[model samples]
Target: MMDYQLNTPLNGNLAMTSCFHENKALQQDTTLYKFIWVRSGILTVEIDHIPMRLEQDEIACLTPLHHIEIKEVEGEYLTFLFNSNFYCIFGHDDEVSCNGFLFHGSSQVMRLKLSPEQSTNLNDIVRIFRQESTVRDNLQEEMLRIILKRFIITCTRIAREKCGVTPEQEKAFDIVRRFYILVDQNFREKKQVRDYADLLFRSPKTLSNLFFSCGVPSPLRIIHERVEAEAKRLLLYTPKSAKEISELLGFEDLSTFSRFFKKMTGESVSDFRKSNTTGSIAN
Candidate 1:
């Protein structure tokens, strides 16, 4: 297992993007709605723990809560991590990579890569990111919004080129889309597989089959993913105790929660909190 130590949660807000770098083997972690564009070198990228590679001129977006890292890849890439949800905009189609990674399934991410002009549009967008980044505009939020939009468009095109997706990929992508959305909404009260099946109107076995075909983990594992993500969120922001958070997140027993949390994130709840200068998560 990779010794994935999280730097910190980048807050719950969707529009506040903090720029930073990840040391190799740190398993660079952050919670943000953003995109990454590789200026140079190959980056071993992962989302939801699925890994893929990002080469030069390749752009990555539509991250549904990313757990990415640079791996052994080196050289700085222009990463324009942004939070576009703060200003609710509507644009995009559902897309998924047939190759792997499972990093993006949202429509906007589907169409946000380089264009046919052969990187002409992307070059322009990169220039904009550089310019805005240098000036540090006061309307930083909105500036990032626009720049990211352009970068996304380019990324979509690039993705379509590098990896021609398959119909099976489309099916897997849809399942992931609905699965992620449902998990986010119901992870707190409904942690069981049957709970999600009831809401999606699909049988647990059927749903499990779909996810498996799409290379997604089992439904139960999906539940743990959401719960773990929320646990990290609470650990970072709210001053909640382990017992409180476990109960709030639908865990029935404190020891069960502790065991699972440690398994998902190779750290105790208290140690995680303490690393960030927070009090022990035990009340």
Candidate 2:
């Protein structure tokens, strides 16, 4: 593993690292949202067990749910790591449409291969992050937030395009957007598509159609994934037992939760927890 770590800025929400890969391995699981910009060379990463090679001018946005191992990095690369709290501020604001299109979007479509002009634009924004870090002014955090918003907006645009998202279809987009928010907020209490459909004043079929049209996954998958994400987080970060976790996620019983988890992730709850903990130990 490479012995490199980024210095945390005064606003600890953000950190920057610059390094060149040469026969080095940096492997770990991360809970923060990570943006890695490949300035030059090839950077290889395994996110959620899928290996990706990002070349020059390409960037990867990894959500907190991913387990990433930096398999190999050759050449220069820059990384910006921040928590979802920072990214999700200004709730439901159009300025930072990051909740679905960027951070919380599908892990399969997270990377953005930048064009030359887009690369220059984003690189310039990155320079601003570097510049703002050197100052201790009262407005430093404010400046960093503005820069971060721009970075997110730029990435969101490219990500939407990559995912074939048509945000201009306001009615369909809003339905799906609301569905995402409702699932995030109520996945524990509402697991079925019919439940969400009732809340959205649309039939289950209509709701599912909207999600499919917007390139969103199936409603049941989204709801189950959200619940499973919380289950994994609690299992990894909390000292809660299976029964306790099941209760916290509003499951009727531990048996049902275990079966659901196994069905969704192809692993038993105890096995999944052990796997994650074992990886943490290995790291």
Candidate 3:
């Protein structure tokens, strides 16, 4: 078995730790976000059934609700765990726009291969975090938040570069983003493109046009996907019954949810749960 260091939790909002072995499998908490930085290792990780390989100086961002397994590790790694409350201290401001693009994104994990300079920069930030974590002064929380903001912003820059996102393109993507925000906030009870359009003060046609221009699926498709995603999360992660999950997702009855799940995932809710439950986590 691999040895592990359980660092003390900082203010109940953040936990920092390091591991240096091929330890037992670990799963992430659904209520917190995680950043895994491989200082010097070749690690194979599985996130939500997708296998990923990380090397030295690489970083991976995982959001709440992702099922992660550290399949194998060779060398050392550092990880930071924090809740969304700590991340969104400025509320829903667009200035620090990482909530959607990094965490809670369609992709379960975002991996960034750090350049040498980038690696050095991130390492310095992590050093500060480690140094501050040892001291519990009044300014510790504020300083941690500031450092975290800097790290997230840096990661966002890398993500933007990897995706080739330009300012003009970002401007054009505003409509698509707003549509997703509305869907995320209201998909439980509202599943129609027209409803989202109304919320965004845009016509259905306009929304459809923007989605098309942005090279994404149509508004209605995105809404259905969001609903399906949440339904799957509930089915796999929670003990709620099919009927309860259906009602929680705003479906009128079990049959309706059954049909919807079958249509979207090509399987019944029961079968999906049975297949996903056992391998989801390790205690």
The estimated TM-scores of all candidates read 0.56, 0.76, 0.79
The best candidate in terms of TM-score: 3
Writing each residue's lDDT as its tens digit, candidate 3 over 1-283 gives: 1222222254236656676223232343456677788889688887665579989988888776676778888877887766756656227446667665666534345688889988888888887877776776777777787877888888888877776677877865766766766777788889888898888888999888876766778888878877887787677667778899899999989999899999988998889888777854332
Q: RMSD per prediction, one decimal?
A: 9.1, 4.7, 4.1
Q: Rate the local accuracy (lDDT) of all candidates.
A: 0.57, 0.72, 0.72
Ranking 1 against 3 by TM-score, winner? 3
- How do these models rank on lDDT, best leading? 3, 2, 1
In candidate 2, the residue pairs with backbone N, CA or C atoms under 3 Å apart (3 or more residues apart, or in different chains) clash, namely: none
How does model 1 fare in lDDT?
A: 0.57
lDDT of 1 by residue, 155-252 (tens): 54466444544655765555555676677667888878998888878899998887776655788987787688667757765688899998998888
Worst 10 residues of 2 by lDDT: 20-29
Off by over 4 Å in 2: 1-12, 19-32, 46-55, 63-69, 83-92, 105-109, 235-239, 274-276, 279-283
